[model samples]
Target chain A: MKADIIVDTKGLACPMPIVKARKAITAMKTGQVMEVLSTDKGSLNDFRAWVSQTKNELIAHEEQNGEYRFWVRKL
Target chain B: MDEKSQKTTIVLFSGDYDKAMAAFIIANGAAAYEHEVTMFFTFWGLNTLRKEAAVRTKKGFLERIFGAMMPRGAEKLGLSKLNMAGMGPQMIKHVIRKHKALPLPQLIELAREQGVKLVACTMTMDLLGLQQEELLDGLEYGGVAAYLGDASDGKVNLFI
Candidate 1:
């Protein structure tokens, strides 16, 4: 998936990754996609919950080699 | 989003560094979700708002002793368990740095930048004989009623 920005939150713990993702997504324009690379296992649920709570949309998400990648579009 | 309805209020009653970190992390997370966040610091929790430099003030002997016994500020706070004479807090700080996680001070700063309200309990301040100058800047002061006013309508209310 293509994204306007890529935020690397690897090695960060719970809440930090989501915090960084929120900041990154907010700085982006509406409809612009953000790719978040996080290593925290909790990112899976964090991203889903964050998307549900905020105005953003989680377009796609996947796990690879212990890393969680999420594609979120600003709304 | 309905700003009024999406509110989170946290009553920070613990002075432990780890506990304070958790509170700020959750508060920051809630703010990220566009919720209005308020953190009320009372009793020991107010220590988290203390400045690194001690403020000169007039106080009774007991009040002075209380001030001397408590941790000076957020940077000087010790862990609640396995503190081992302050070694535990250092270890936790090392681990946090190794993981590239934002430390407590930075998290508090970010929380402020995100518009999370940091409120100091006025009654506690009086009881502890703490002056306003003793605390860090950018804070709101209030009593239990003030906390209740904010927490009453909040969807998420926590005591930590």
Candidate 2:
């Protein structure tokens, strides 16, 4: 899963990770993929909710060693 | 996106820094979700829009005292609890910075960047004797009707 841009939100709290992700996604072109690395536990649900609300596609998401990675494609 | 169907309105009535942060965070978050968002600042919440420098204005004795007691601007706001003469806000700011989290001002800026409407309650401004020049620029001024108009069809309405 390759991405056009990778945003590392590690160690950031709720809203910050989502805020940073939104900013990153906004800069990318449509159909481009963004990889977000966040350590916030709540991001699992936050990203899902964000994608649902914004109509963006969450192509892939996984958690490992307490880190959450999400691959989102801009709509 | 159906902008008309997805609307969020926040009535920020608290002057506390922590509460203000929460309001901005929620507002920014909703805006990120492609929702039309509006924030109405009234009473003490108007302090968040105040400028650091004092702007001279004619006011009654009560309004003068109100102005003197409240923090001049967002930068001077204290935490709602455990403020310890303002140490709490500083500590929280330090933590937010350490965590790479956006502070309230930055959050507000991001909200604006995301097209969130910032509205100042004109009635409260008059009551508190806050002049237009005393507040930060790029804000819409209106009374409760304006707020009610924005909040009426909003799917999410919050008072913080």
Task: Give the interface RMSD of candidate 1.
Answer: 1.4
The DockQ figures for the candidates are 0.74, 0.65
lDDT of 2 at A66: 99
Give per-residue CA lDDT, model 1, range B49-122, as digits (tens). 99988899989998888888888888899999988999999999999999878899999898998899999999
TM-score on alpha carbons, each prediction: 0.95, 0.92
Q: Find the candidate with the highest DockQ and give its number.
A: 1
CAPRI quality of model 1:
medium
Q: Which stretches of candidate 1 lie over 4 Å from their true place?
A: B1-5
Predicted model with the maximum lDDT: 1
Native A-B contacts reproduced, model 1: 0.79
lDDT of 2 at B111: 86
User: Which 10-residue window in model 2 chain B sums to the lowest lDDT?
Assistant: B1-10
* All candidates: TM-score of chain A: 0.95, 0.97
**Candidate 2 Cα errors over 4 Å, as ranges:** B1-5
Best by TM-score: 1
